[model samples]
Target: MVKVATYFAMTFGAFLFWQSMDRVHVWIALHQDEKKERMEREQEIKRMQAELMAQAKESES
Candidate 1:
């Protein structure tokens, strides 16, 4: 009976560890995706600014 209880305890501990690791992986993935989106937005803003500058230069000419 004691051996069975020990095995059960070990299994439960391993299961919990695996679940925590899975959560950590998900969080990392979400963070990376957010970073990528932010970079893309910055690139878009830069492109728009360049276009506006070109338009202004043409008007001045």
Candidate 2:
């Protein structure tokens, strides 16, 4: 009886650990996606600024 109880406890602990790891993996993936989007947005903003500067220079000339 003691052995069976120990086995059950270990199985439950493993299941909990697996679920926590899955959550961590998902969180990491989401964080990476957000970072990628932020970088893309920054690049777009920089591009627009450069284009505007070029247009202003053309008007001045």
Candidate 3:
């Protein structure tokens, strides 16, 4: 009876560990996606600023 109880406890622990790892993986994936989007937006803003600068230079010429 003790052996059976030990096995059950181990199995339950493994299941809980797996669930926690899955949640961690999901959070990491979401964070990476958000970081990528932020980087893309920054690049776009830089591109727009460069275009405006070029236009200003042309108008001055």
**Off by more than 4 A, model 3:** none
Encode model 2's per-residue lDDT on 1-61: one tens digit a residue.
Answer: 9999999999999999999999999999999999999999999999999999999999999
List the candidate 2 regions with Cα displacement exceeding 4 Å: none
What is the TM-score (0 to 1) of candidate 2?
0.96
* Local accuracy of candidate 3 as per-residue lDDT tens digits, 1-61: 9999999999999999999999999999999999999999999999999999999999999
lDDT of 1 by residue, 1-61 (tens): 9999999999999999999999999999999999999999999999999999999999999
Worst window of 10 by summed lDDT in candidate 3: 1-10
For each candidate in turn, the TM-score is 0.90, 0.96, 0.96
Between which residue pairs do clashes occur in model 2?
none
Which pairs clash in the backbone of model 1? Answer: none
Greater TM-score among 1 and 3 belongs to 3
In candidate 1, what residue range of length 10 has the lowest lDDT sum?
A: 1-10
* Cα lDDT for residue 14, candidate 2: 100
Clashes of each: 0, 0, 0
Q: Which stretches of candidate 1 lie above 4 Å from their native place?
A: none
